[model samples]
Target: MTDYSSISTKYRAYNITPDTLAGIVAVVKKFTEGPATTTIYLDDDHEVKDHNLDALLADSFVKAQKIQRIKIESRKTLGPDLVHSISINFESDMLRVVQVTITGDRDRAILARRELDTLLHGAEYWYSFSLAPRSSFLPFFLSFLIPIVLISALSVFLTWLFGGEVTEKSTTGWVLLPLVVFLAGYFGLKDYVFPRLTFDIGRSADRIKIAGYWRNILLTGIVIGIVVKIAIDRLLK
Candidate 1:
C-alpha cells in the first residue's frame, strides 16, 4: 500500500544589481526603453527595512552588481509580457545606456526638413526654378500688336500725304483691289497659317519642321491688308 502526499509551493524575492551602474544610468537618460513600473519586495524581518525599492533605484552613487535581474510586466495585449526578467552582466560603473537607431527613411525626413527651411527663408531665390517655360504668350501677343500699330501708322501717313482728298474715284480702286487680295489670302490660310505659326512659336523651337515660311508670311500680310482696308472704308465714311 502507498501513501499519497500533497505538494507545497514556496515564493521568494531576490535583489537585482546591474553590472554597470553607469551603463544603466545612460540607458535611463536616453529613454530608449519605455518607462518601467517596478515593484520591490523586501524581507520585513531584515534590519535594512527603511530603504525602499524606489529609493534604492534612485540613488546616484549606487553601484549595481554584475549579475542583476529586473522584473517587468505588460499592461496591454500588444505589450510585452509582464514578470519578465532581464540579466545585466556588464561593468557596474560604465553607466547603462540604450540607443535607438534611425532608419534610412528617417534620415531622409531630416534632410527634407532642412530643404523646406531653406525654401521658406528665401522663396524668391528659387523662383527661376519654376517648371514653366520662358517666352510665353506675352511675347507673341506683343509681336502681333506691334505689326498692327505699324500698319495703322502707315495708313495715317499716306492719308495725310494725300492732303485728305475726299475723291472716291482716285482711291476706291486701289483700296478695293488690296481689300480683295487680303480677303482671299486671309480666308484661304486662316485654317493653316495662323495655327501653324502660333504652334511653332508656342511649342518647342525644334518642332517647326514643316516648310513654307514665306507662304505663311504672305498669307498673313494679305489678311491684315484686307482687314485694314475695311476699317479704313468704314472710317472714311
Candidate 2:
C-alpha cells in the first residue's frame, strides 16, 4: 500500500466556508477512529477562542490551529470565492483514512465517505459477487436474468409438487416467483445462511467469507435447477 501520509492530502471544494470546514472536521472525527489532524489553509491571519469556528474566520479563511487532541490546522484558500484546496497529514496505525471526491457536490462526497467508512469498519464480509464497471451491461443483464433463472428452476419444483409436467404454460405463475423468493430469502433464508451482502472492499480481514460462499452455492443450485427444468420443459413439449 502507498503511504497515505506521504501522499499529500490534496482536495478542492467550491465555495468553502468556516462552517463547511467545521462540519467536515466533525464528520472525519465521527466516522474515523484514532488520532487524526486537519490543516486548514487560510487566506489571512485570524484569532480563535472558544468552540465557535465563526470567530476563527476573518474574511477569506480561518486561522490554522490545533484544537483539542484532534489536531486541527486551518488556513485560507487561494481565494475566498474561488475553489479551495487543502491537505491533511496523519500518523498511520491509529486512524483509517477515507476520502471521497465528487465534482460539483461536496455534501454528497462527505455523506458517501462517511457511509463508506461505516460499512468498511462496521462489519465483516463472508462472500460477494462483484458487478463491476457500472457503465457496462453485465450488471443489468445478470440482475434480470439471474432472477429469471431462479424462477425457472422454482417452476420445476412446483411441477414436482403437483406431479404435473413442467411447461411454459404450466409455469406462468413463475412470473411471481422472483418476488416470493426475495421475501423468503430476505426474511428467512439469508439470516441462517449468509449474514450480509456487501460491496467488494478488496481482500481484507473485514471481508465476510461465509456470505460470499453461500451466495455462490445458492447461485450454483439455481443454475442446476434451471438446467433440469429446461430439459423437463423440452421433454414435455
Q: How accurate is candidate 2 locally (lDDT)?
A: 0.39
Query: How many pairs in model 1 have backbone atoms within 3 A of each other, for residues 3 or more apart or on separate chains, i.e. clashes?
Result: 21
lDDT winner among the candidates? 2
Model 1 residue 132 lDDT score: 22
Candidate 2: misplaced stretches above 4 Å? 1-76, 85-164, 171-183, 186-207, 223-237
TM-score of 2: 0.30
Clash count of each predicted structure: 21, 21
Highest TM-score among the candidates is held by which one? 2
What's the lDDT for residue 121 in model 2? 38
C-alpha TM-scores of all predictions? 0.19, 0.30
Tens-digit lDDT string for candidate 2 (122-209): 3323332322223347764674466556665665665554455555566545435654766567447643354322212222112245
